[model samples]
Target: MPQGPGYATDLADRYDDWFAPPAATTDATVALLARLAGSAPDGPLLELGIGTGRVALPLAARGHDVHGIDASTTMVERLRAKPGGEKLTVSIGDFAEVDHEGEFAVAYVAGGTFFELRTQQAQLRCFAQAARRLLPGGLFVLDAHLPEALAAHAGAGAQTVETANGDPVLRVRRLRPAGQRYTSDYLVFADGLFRHVRVDFRYASPGELDLMAAAAGLRLRERFGGWSGTPFSDTSGYHVSVYELPA
Candidate 1:
């Protein structure tokens, strides 16, 4: 229900380059997700916010049918331009409300995209939709950074960093603890011009997320600090959580 300056076409074109050094995380992410995927079922695997097929294409290469839903047509178009990308069935729409045929054995969102939904109600709707899209006992996986770190920086105003590509980017963030919302405004200098993008995130603690998943008929099954299966602890920066629908 909440939307802002979502992934723009220009930003989509530079996404891969901006996140270069994909080898650092992409391989591990795909490997762990593939393991979690287990044996392929009759239904295709589903990826929410499947940006540029970063994880989906690799999974599809492993012979599992893969479908994706994303709100960015530019991102989907970039995915389509890749080798073997044409094999994927990607729909352009909000992953939270998009309708896809058949049930999925596994559904996931990577890179903290789950937090992009700016309201608890919308997030709950997403969980319900995922439950409806999955077969009984199907898996739902989420990868997100903990809010504790951001909470530490409440009302810190603007910060800037230079990308590896020599672009200077400025970020301004405001955190609202009462609603567990974090809003970010990014200004990126590229091609001798500056562009702005705004993103609002609704973050939940692990326990809160479990409750939301339960409301949607999913039970927590597994959780880890990272892709290597490290145990989650208070000091952990991010978490990968898996939930299951009742069989």
Candidate 2:
């Protein structure tokens, strides 16, 4: 197993503003998926890499039976602090190794969390594990940058983040694909206040992800270019795919 990434420590430190799942993004994605998964007000939904409940809390509030797992304790703790979060069951451990004793109606990994795992084997293992977590026919949704987009936008330049409270932070993500995986790095700075950086990895296209899912015994169900159900184009920023385990 890969040891902890230094980037995770940075994510832990910025638990409140940066790492916590943003409600707006989560709500939109979940709403779309709820319809896709045929979710009722009551859903037995599962989320992996449930960082700070961005998507999980809202899904729970919408009355889904949401369960989540994350590798970060700080993220899990922060998640429990949000509204309607008291009842959520969040595990603090490697989601890859954790034992989830039940099958869900739907399972999801959102907000580019898939790319953070760092290796093709690790990424593939996640798909295999997701297959085990789902009930037969349960949907597993994944979102990440498409390989085609990388060629179109080599090292898709700089992005900065400013917190609601204090200092501004400049963070740049570099996306470089080798074979079927993306090697990435995040250079972060607290504007002129503090400067720190981390290097990491993200992965390739939906086709690569699908191959992993296939090896794990899950079938491709659907795919969209974006959360808005945009048609996938070679130029789109991501490939959002929904895979289903055999019923």
Candidate 3:
């Protein structure tokens, strides 16, 4: 079972594999942030728990100023190793604890990082700190998995996929008790060899997320089923909700 606090430590070495994206969905949330950022500071966007530069550097490449903070030095170090990462700025600190003076046009937590905070108090503090990083009328975006998809896979199951190299892939799933964590086991067949890897993520419901945003004095502006503007529904697999810092 994966709890909130030890999540980063457990995921540190294997972070890249879990988030390893082939194409289409990579930084899918970025498009929404760019769109919602309209009429805001445009000064610089702040990313909470920005991992591996999935969205930060790309946003910077698009000519928007970006800054990010993460608790894992290992994650930040890996981000710094990436091409665009070397040039981008990242702070090695907790999003809930780190204090920055600059007001941002947009502050976001992508790839489900928002739920890593675990407890309601910590989650609320994260929102409070993140909101303070934003200027008035600034936008705060958060992406998380939908409860239905998780409930759909309540039991363990497996799927086979191929990697970019045409290697066979086997993915197994198991939902932890209370729906607080998900464990995925992946077996890869490459070079006529097979190796198994595992991944874990802490889960949060949409209602829990809404309450956290409200706790920080931020209003839920809109909720989307996916990064591509799908309307939020119980059946949707994931969510992308935008919040306001009480302009």
Better of 2 and 3 by lDDT: 3
* TM-score: the better of candidates 1 and 3: 1
Tens-place lDDT per residue, model 2, 1-247, is 3333555544655645543334555566878777866832224888877876777776777777788877766666667777877798876666665356677878888877777777677788788887887877788888887666654544556555544334555555555544444444334444454546564656666777878889999988778887777887755778778888777
Mind giving the per-residue lDDT tens digits that candidate 1 earns over 62-149? Answer: 9988899887778888899999998898887777884677799899988678998877887888899998998877888998878887
| Cα-based lDDT for every prediction | 0.80, 0.69, 0.72
How far residue 186's Cα lies from its native spot in candidate 2, in Å, is: 4.6
TM-score of each: 0.88, 0.84, 0.81
Evaluate residue 13 in candidate 3 and report its C-alpha lDDT on the 0 to 100 scale: 46
- For all the candidates, what are their Cα RMSDs to the real structure? 2.6, 3.1, 3.7
Instruction: Give the candidate number with the greatest lDDT.
Output: 1
The candidate scoring highest on TM-score is 1
Please write out the lDDT profile of model 3 over residues 1-247, one tens digit for every residue. Answer: 2222343455444455543555455556666677777656556888888777877877778788888887777677777887778876777776765465578889888766776665556677878887777788888888887766766665437776534345567777677747477766777665577766665666777887788788888889889997878898756888888888777
lDDT of 2: 0.69
Report how far residue 206 has shifted in candidate 3, in Å. Answer: 1.2
